[model samples]
Target: MPDASPTLGEAGAASVSPTAVLTIYIPSEAPQDKVTRAIDAILAAHPWEVPVIEVSETRLVMCG
Candidate 1:
């Protein structure tokens, strides 16, 4: 069957504000470990504490 889910590129088009809960959908095949490691490295190298990163595979629906 054809994929029915929206792609990361499409989902990212939505506005993301600090006051709002923004959900980012990344590819399942992506190397999450590497991404987290990179993020950790950046945080360690910098002085700012990065926001909490919650990872999960769940379906999301948006109604207008």
Candidate 2:
């Protein structure tokens, strides 16, 4: 007997992938303490134990 599994071209054959993006905004007038806490919270919630962190004058990016 032949196997029953359908080929990639069949209906429901292709799998769907998921993605997530996080963006943080810091105002020019925001306090340093508040900014620190916000960044800390973001790092704490990230999945990676040691995420690669990068920053510029305006933004921060964290990648695992």
Candidate 3:
């Protein structure tokens, strides 16, 4: 018989605290309003603390 257990990434994983920091990455092509609405909906469901959002287009580039 196999050991029936849920992995860390499974649904049994611990839930995140509302005050925990959230990091979201929006694709360049995604609509800002739509993304904002989706984020708002998530926040509304969990009621998290005000997040530190950083929006940048060039942050992922290498300057070497």
Candidate 4:
């Protein structure tokens, strides 16, 4: 049987599956301890882990 999965040209088909973006904008004047705890909590909530091969200033290169 042919696959029922949506192809690239289909509407609402996300180019990257299971995508997430983490963006935090704590003011520079915020307390260090509070900021640290907030960041820790956010990270703890999303516990998914991937095997990253390299990390740079701009991007993360994950292992295939």
User: Which candidate leads in TM-score?
Assistant: 2
Q: After TM-score superposition, what is the CA distance of residue 46 in candidate 4 from its true location, in Å?
A: 1.1
- Pull out the clashing pairs in model 2: none
RMSD (Cα, Å) of model 4:
12.7
lDDT of each: 0.54, 0.61, 0.59, 0.52
**Residue 5 miss distance in model 1 (angstroms):** 41
Per-residue lDDT of candidate 3, residues 1-64 (tens digit): 1332422223435544335556677788898899889777876765324344566664576788
lDDT of 3: 0.59
Candidate achieving higher lDDT, 3 or 4: 3
In Å, residue 17's CA in model 4 sits off its true spot by: 5.0
TM per candidate: 0.33, 0.49, 0.40, 0.44
lDDT of 2 at 7: 28
CA shift of 20, model 1, Å: 3.0
Task: State, as a TM-score between 0 and 1, how close model 4 is to the true structure.
Answer: 0.44
Report, for all candidates in order, the number of backbone clashes.
0, 0, 0, 0
Tens digits of per-residue lDDT, candidate 1, 2-62, equal 3323322233254334343445666667797977886576557643233555778876689
Q: Which digits, one per residue and each the tens of the lDDT, describe model 2 over residues 20-47?
A: 6666567878898998898898788876
- Candidate 1 lowest-lDDT run of ten: 1-10
Q: lDDT of candidate 4?
A: 0.52
| Best candidate according to lDDT | 2
What lDDT, from 0 to 1, does candidate 2 have?
0.61
